[model samples]
Target: MLELEGIETGYGETRVVHGLDLTVREGTVHALLGRNGVGKSTTLKSVIGQLPVTVGTVRLAGQQISGRLPHDIARLGVAYVPETRDIFGALTVRENLELAGRLAGPGADWTVDRIVAFFPNLAERLNNGGHELSGGEQQMLAVGRALMASPRILMLDEPTEGLAPIIIQQIFGKLKELKASGLTILLVEQNLNFALGLADDISLMGRGQIVWRGDAAALKADDQAHARWLGV
Candidate 1:
């Protein structure tokens, strides 16, 4: 559902992502794994139109979206949840979901009730401000907000970073459920076990390029690749 060919993008003149090529099939979870500075996040930003692609083509569902504006790309059924978990600190939980749903229009599949059902903790804290929630709660809120867009492809950067193990498990479970529901996902993750457990396909990046690509089981068995690039 998503493909990036010869992707070369970076901040200003320094190219961080060098001739990267990737493909995420429909209704599957594809994980991008790499150490710090391998351009995993930059690749995602380039695809989502946050970072400029100096040389490449980004296609979503066979439509070119390389140089489009971020909002315009989002309108084409692409939802990006950055590592920062960008939520409105001043907005109450209910208000945040309401605003996202309103922006998504009436045909969105994700509703406030459904989001709450997926995240029962959010249901009880509907009136709480975003700032009032814990780190895990905030991450849940971020994912919930992205789902509110009713996206065909969900891109997440470091969703499990700094969360408790229990919360991470919960997040993984929700992602599994989303995958089961035929949601295509592109995930940039540092956690090896987490990525290996949930991803159908895995790609390892090094020096802004994809060094290895394989199924999850193949990656699990390739200890040399894991140690060389991922330091695992």
Candidate 2:
């Protein structure tokens, strides 16, 4: 569902991602794993149109999406939940979801009611301000808001960062449900077990390029690649 070929992008004069090539198949969870400073996030930024692709191509569903505006790319059915977990601090939980649904427009399968059902904890805190929620609730709100867009492909960067193990399990459970419902996912994760447990396919990145690509079982069994590139 998503493809990047020879993707090269960086901040300012220093190039971080070098000739990165990767693909995420439809209805599958593709995990991009690497140690810090290897440009995993940069590759995601390039695909989502936040970073300029100086070289190579990005395609979604067989159409060229490279160089498109971020919102334009989003309208093409890509939903990105950055590591920042950016949500309006002052808005009520219900209000945030409302705004997201409005932005997503009509005819989307993800309605406020549907999302509230998917996230029942969010339903209980409908009137609470975003700032009043706990870390886990905030993360759930972020994912819930993204789903309000009814996106075909969900791209997450460090979705489990800084959360407790219980919270991580909850988030992963939601993700598993989403995957079961046939949504494609591209995840950049640091937790080896989390990625290995959930990912259908895995790609190890090193020095800004994909060094190995295989199924999750293969990645689990490849001790050399894990030690060399992932430092696991």
lDDT of 1 by residue, 204-223 (tens): 99999999999888987898
Q: In angstroms, how far off is 105's CA in candidate 1? A: 4.4
In candidate 2, position 143 carries an lDDT of 91
List model 2 lDDT by residue over 142-220, tens digit each: 9998899888899999999999999999899999999999999999999888888889999989998999999888977
Maximum-lDDT candidate: 1
Residue pairs in candidate 1 whose N, alpha carbon or C atoms collide under 3 angstroms: none
Give the distance in Å from residue 28's predicted Cα in candidate 2 to where it truly belongs. Answer: 0.4
Would you estimate the TM-scores of all the predictions?
0.97, 0.96
Clashes of 1: 0
Note the Cα lDDT for every prediction shown: 0.91, 0.89
lDDT, model 2, position 185: 96
* Candidate 2 stretches greater than 4 Å from native: none
